[model samples]
Target: MIGKWLDIGPTTQIEPGSARTLPVFGGEEIAVFHTVRGEFYALVNKCPHKAGPLSQGIIHGDSVTCPLHNWRISLRTGEALGEDKGCTPTIPLKIDGGRIFLLREAVVA
Candidate 1:
């Protein structure tokens, strides 16, 4: 029902070092992050450990620490950081004209 990319509004929607949730119609919920370094990334909202909501996790560098168990997940690669195991899926994302766009194929069918 949408185009090749999902336009998720302006970059200002998410503040630095924070994240927001985007519900996907045919896939898992996505967590969009605005790092303090002015970079943006999108990953599955679910944590690899215990399926915790990654959106509620604390953002530090390019990683988010799972609030459920302090499991750190890399925003860029979605891999668990440090000794943590497992990984969450990362949705391809980009920014243009101050708006965030997610790869349509990686998001929903």
Candidate 2:
């Protein structure tokens, strides 16, 4: 568990059923999303293609559509769907008492 607690503002920053980008650890961005099931997920904000910000992407169910080139990445597995190649790193997020926390390092599988 290379997990580290990353402070990404308050829990309210990520609206329910929505995703947002957070800047931490030397300006590295992380995309935080709250599922309709009330579960939280976090991933690298940069897309594998052209380094697009995945946080600005749209959330459709358990997938996120990269805003840069319409590439879709799974919020759960960080695997690019459709015609995309390569996978983005994912950080595990655990929120406790209104403070959003994430692992300092991402795990790419």
Candidate 3:
């Protein structure tokens, strides 16, 4: 399914500065985010620091702060910011006709 897109849902389902979760049957749970600036991003729901559910974390700009440890993660790169030293996995996403899609392979692999 290379180059294929998996339609998650419409953009408006997730409010600005918030996120929604998509569960993969046998894979990792994903967090789809809509930034206050109207940008969209997707990452593995887990935080790099303590595996906190990022979908439950607070979004600010292009970063998300882990709710458990308050570690900030870069939404664009999935890197733990500041004194942190870990990285989460980011999923490739695109917005088309107000719908959100994730790369098919990336979502399952």
Candidate 4:
């Protein structure tokens, strides 16, 4: 389950295969990605390893290759791929009426 949903902006604000980082309260940042398949995903902007900016990573399918170390991360689950270790935090997201909404609570375990 998720907590209060906050509207980020219209879906059009983020192009497919691209990402946008939004700074939230408490100095934390969230990375919102629009996949080529038109799906939206939200996760912590920082990578679990080295704290790299995931928003600048390359989007491939439902995953992103971290720019700092090429660590592939699942956009849907925020899990590190292959032999990589650790996982980033994922935020629940929903799209309605062409607008994007993010759950205020972190969905990570």
Sort every candidate by TM-score, greatest first: 3, 1, 4, 2
- Model 2, residue 87: distance off in Å is 0.6
Superior candidate under TM-score, 1 versus 2: 1
Question: What lDDT would candidate 2 get against the real structure?
Answer: 0.78
lDDT top scorer: 3
Candidate 2 Cα errors over 4 Å, as ranges? 1-4, 7-10, 105-109
lDDT of 2 by residue, 1-109 (tens): 4445656678777787788876665668777888777778888888888788887777888888878889898888989898678798888878889888876555222
* Model 4 lDDT tens row, 1-109: 4447788899999999999999887788899999999999999998888889999999999999999999999998999999999799898999989999987655322
Which pairs clash in model 3?
none
Candidate 3: stretches off by over 4 Å: 1-3
State TM-scores per candidate.
Answer: 0.94, 0.77, 0.94, 0.92
Could you tell me how far off, in angstroms, the CA of residue 73 lies in candidate 1 after the best superposition? 0.3
The CA lDDT of each predicted structure is: 0.92, 0.78, 0.94, 0.90
Candidate 1 lDDT, 1-109, residue by residue in tens? 5588888899999999999998888757999999999999999999988999999999999999999999999999999989888989999999999999999888776
Which regions of candidate 1 are displaced past 4 Å?
Answer: none
Lowest summed lDDT across 10 adjacent residues in model 2 is found at 100-109
Compose the digit string of candidate 3's lDDT tens values, residues 1-109. 5559999999999999999999885768999999999999999999988899999999999999999989999999999999899999999999999999999988865
TM-score of 1: 0.94
